[model samples]
Target: MVTRKLAAVAAALLTGTLSLTACSTGSSGGGSSDPGDSQLNKVLKAGELRVAVLPDFPPWAVQKADGSFEGYEIDIAHELADSLGVKLKLVSTDGDSRLPMLQSNRVDVNVSAWTSTNERAQTAGFTIPYDAHGAGVLFKKGADITSYQDLAGKSVSVARGSTNDTILTNDFPSAKPVRFDAISDVISAVKTGKVDAALESSYTVAQAAKSDPELEAISNPPLDPQLVSMGVLPGDQVWINYLNNFIRNLIASGEDNKLHEKWLGEPLASIVSVQGNAA
Candidate 1:
C-alpha cells in the first residue's frame, strides 16, 4: 500500500506536455458486421487474466523497490481485470521478450507499452487506441541539440524493433544509429556519451530526464504517434469483439481518459477528429 505522502510525491513527479497530432489511417475493418461472438466468456471462465509488462518501463510498467509491479499500465491492467471480474496476474518481461511471452501464452495480454502499428497488427490486434504515443531524444542538458536533421553525423541510440527505430531508419537515414537491447541501454548510452543522443519514448524519457538532471529530453519530440493496444491471442473473434466493445464503453464513460491521467499525469486532451479508420 502507498503512504499518502509518497503517493503525493509520485503524482507530483509525474507530469507531461502532450501535443496532439493529426490522425489518419487505412480503412477501418468496419464492424464485425454481423456481430461475430464474445470472448468475454472464455476470459471469465478462466477466472484469471495473465498480463505481461516490461518492468523497467516507467510510467507504463515498472517493478517497485518492494519487488512488485507498479506503473500506469500496471494499475490500468488491474482495473481492467477487476472490471472483468477476474484476477489480473502480472508477469514482468523485458521489452524484447514481450511478443514471445504473448506467443507462448505465458501471458494472456501484452500491456507493456505495446504500440499498435500496421506491421504488428498483421500478427496481432490492438485495442482501439486510447492515446497517441510520441517519441523523443534524451541528451545531456545544455548540450544544445533538437530536431531529427541535427542527428546528421552524430551517433543516436535506439531500441531494437521499436517504432523509434523505424522512424529513425526512415527519417534520419544519415545518422550513425546505435541499436540497443532495451530503452534503459539507450538511455545509458546517451548519458555516458556513448552516443550523441538516444531515441526513446517521450513519456518514459521525460521521467528519466527528471530523475537525472544531467540528461534532458531534446525538443521536437518525434511524433509518429502509434496507437497503443492490448494484445491477445490471434484469431479469436469472440475475444476481439468483446475487447473492442469494452474499449468503446470505456471511452464512452470517460474512464479511458481517466486511466491516462491517473498513470501519465496528463489529461489526454486532444483535438481528435472523429474518424472511422484506425490510427
Candidate 2:
C-alpha cells in the first residue's frame, strides 16, 4: 500500500514539475521567463542579432565582390547590433524571403528596406519609418512614357514580392507586370529591352540612371510613396517596441540623416519626410 502511495506521489510531482516548466516557457518554446519577451530575450541571451537584407539592392544592401555586405542597410544593421550589445549576422534574402525569415524565427528582424503596408502589418510588426521613397519608373531614354497612364498595355518589370510589385499588380491593372527574383534582374529586363520599363525604388532608379546614359527615370510624380521600416514577426510586442525605440533614437540623434547623406549623397528630406513622431 505504501509503495503504491509513493508511486502516486512521484507521478503527481512529475506532472506538477512539467506544468511549471511549460508555463515558464510559454508558447514561444524558447523557455523565456517572461512569455512576452520571447524574441527580445532570445536575442539578448544568444548575443547575436540576425537581420534579413536584400543582397542585390545596391546603395541599400549588396553583397560585394569580396563576399561581404556593405550599404545603407548593412550600416543600419551594424548600428542595431551595436545598440543591443550583440553581434550582427546579416542573412542574405530577397524581397520574397524577408518576411518568411522572420516568421520562421530564422531572423530576429528585417532591415531590408521593407515598406510598411496594411496587408503586411496583419502578419508582422513594423517600426516607424526610418526611410521612405516612392516607386519610380526607369525606362530607356527617349521613351514616350511620361506617366502611369502611358504604360497601358505595356509591360513593366519589378522585383518579385516587393512593394513595387504589389503596387504594379494592384494599382496599375492597365500595365502588365513581369516579376523577377532580384532587383538586378528587374533592371536588366528594362536595359535589355525585354520590358518596357522597370518600376523600382525611387532611390535605386535614380542610381541606375546615373550609371547608364541610356536610362532615365520618368519625371512624373513618384508612385505609392512608401515608408520603409524594420519588420519583425508579430505577437512579440516587446521585441517590436525595442526596435521602434531604436529607430526613434536614431532619428532623434540625427544618425539616420547621416546615414542617408553617407550612402545616398542626399539629405533625408530629399527622399522622405523627417517625421519621426509615429509610434
Candidate 3:
C-alpha cells in the first residue's frame, strides 16, 4: 500500500499534477493561531509556497537526470504546498544555504534535511520533528575502522556545514577532515579513495553501501542522532505553528510512516532516537 501511494505521489510530481486542498487549514493541534501575521498568510495569499530543498541529498532529495526532484523531503514539501492550496516552487539549496535562503526571503521554508540544533534555533524557527536519523562512518571493506575510536587517526570526508562535519571537528580532532559542499561529493571522496571514510547520515551511508558491494557503512550504535524539521524565518511564530500542526496531521494520518517506509525502506522505530545537541 505504501509503495502504491508513493508511486502515485511520484507520478503526480512528474506530471506536475499534485492534488491540493481548496484552502489552507490547520490541523487539530491548533490551526495557525496567527495566520495573518506571518509567512503563512503571505504564502496563502500569493497562492504559492516557495520551499528550499537540497538538490543532491539522495533518499531525502535527489535531482533526477531530467531536472526533476523526487525524494522523502520532496514529498514533504509537496504535501505542505498541497495542504496550503498553493503551487509549490522548489528552490535548490546545499548544506550551507538553507538558513541564508530563509533569511533572505528567497524561500518561505526549508525542508532540506535540516537537523534541529539550539544554535540554529537562535537564527531560525523549526517545526516539530517530522523525521530523524543518525550519523555513520562509511568506509571500504578493508578499512581499519571498527568503532568511533578507530576514526580518531583516519581521514574522513564530511559535507561542509553539516552536523557530520561538526562531529568530525569537535569529537575527533585528531582525524583529518575533508570538507565537501555536497553529500555526493563526500561519498565520492570515499569511493575514489581520496578519503579513508565519510561521516554521513546512517541512511545515506546504507544506501551508498547498498549500491557498491565494496563499500560498507558502520552504523551500529549510530552516532549523534538528530531530529529533523522544516526551517522557517526566525520569529515567524504563526508559520512555525502551522507547520507543526501540519506535521501532527501527517503523523496522525499515518502518511509520515508510509512516506518513511517508501524512501528509507524501514519503519521509523528502527531508526535511532537522540536527545539532540547537548550544547
Candidate with the greatest TM-score versus the true structure: 3
Q: Where is the poorest 10-residue window by lDDT in model 3?
A: 270-279
Instruction: Assess each prediction's global lDDT (C-alpha) against the native.
Output: 0.66, 0.76, 0.78
Best-to-worst ranking by TM-score:
3, 2, 1
- List clashing residue pairs in candidate 1: 39-238, 39-239
lDDT ranking from best candidate downward: 3, 2, 1
Look at candidate 2 and tell me the lDDT of residue 128.
73
lDDT of 1: 0.66
| TM per prediction | 0.78, 0.83, 0.84
Please provide, for model 2 over 1-279, each residue's C-alpha lDDT reduced to its tens digit, 9 standing for 90 to 100: 001232232233333331322222123312233433557767767889999998888789889889899998899888888777779899998888876687677998999988888987766677777888788899999888887778778899999888898888888898989999989899999899999999998888888999999998987778888788888766555555556657766765677888888888876763343455342
lDDT of 2 at 172: 85
- Write candidate 3's Cα lDDT for 18-52 as tens digits: 33222343332222334354677677678889999
Clashes of 2: 0
